[model samples]
Target: MAVHKVSLDEFEEIEYSIIAIHTPLEDYRLAYTLNLILELNLSRSAKDILIDIKEGKSFFSKYTFYDCKKDITWHLIQNKNEVTQRNNKKKATLFFDQNLEIPAQTYLLPELKKADFFLKIEACHNNFNVTKTVAKMNTIATINMVYSVKTETIKSKNNLIF
Candidate 1:
């Protein structure tokens, strides 16, 4: 058998079909109740979203959610969404490229806006299936991240800050 070596860059195009997600338990409650969700490029689905949270894998990614405190609205969770229902039935969705600013009011890890992410991401959504619009969810992932922080940029005011 001939031996071959694969380089790290080769995996850059790879994406996980599924992944596990996590966040500070308290944060999840607040975000969920507020009807805030993470913004993402999503494909449509048929039927109500039927995923097992106990399965430990979801579509959460590392993206910052902006102005959530200002944008939180009950309408997001109120259901009866004609747009969402249509998309799910049609099986097609448009790409939304913009992202919200990180919410600054959270007491939890306020300094970290986006979860440090490193993965082959296709796109993820949190739509009516999960109880809120996908646009308000935040990614605080805990699984399928195979790389480490190899380097971080340092800024100097006189040399120190984490």
Candidate 2:
């Protein structure tokens, strides 16, 4: 896996080079890959970080903030279609495969601004609050300091669950 580091404005953006892997296939390590990328990019502390996942659909199974102590904000953009927001303080992780059994907490709205896809995921006590909307070929999810908090874990993992 190759890593590309670039700084934009006051935010730091990191793009991980990954081989395109189609969905519904085993041996998919997108979760682990994302974890590694986050770890590498997070080495330098910053107020905000943007991770652009434009390569392809990534399957992330775990996301932990054990080493992160700062109140960092993460903006995750996927395929320039979907986006997920998360605070560094809240230990966040994701787990899912082709057969997505987890229900979508947020759906993309059409009234909002047009984008590929944006989905915001804010880690709370137990569950994560999700907000999503779709426009054109994009889906958008936004989360700020004001969003309802839910109580659910992505993979039933102990690291993220309190």
Q: Over 4 Å off in model 1, which ranges?
A: 13-25, 37-162
Q: What TM-score fits each model?
A: 0.19, 0.18
lDDT of 1 at 25: 35
- Per-residue lDDT of 1-162 in model 2, one digit per residue for the tens? 999887677684331111112222121233333335334231212322232233323232222232244333232322212334332244334853233222222212222222222223322232321232112102111211122222232231122211
Alpha-carbon RMSD, candidate 2: 20.7
| Top candidate by TM-score | 1
Looking at model 1, residue 62 earns an lDDT score of 24
- Highest lDDT, which number? 2
Candidate 1's TM-score: 0.19
Query: Weakest 10 consecutive residues, lDDT, candidate 1?
Result: 76-85
lDDT of the candidates, in the order given: 0.25, 0.26
Per-residue lDDT of candidate 1, residues 1-162 (tens digit): 999999988875311121112333332343343332343322222222222232222222122232343332121111011111112233333854343332212111212223322211222322223322222233334222222211232121111110
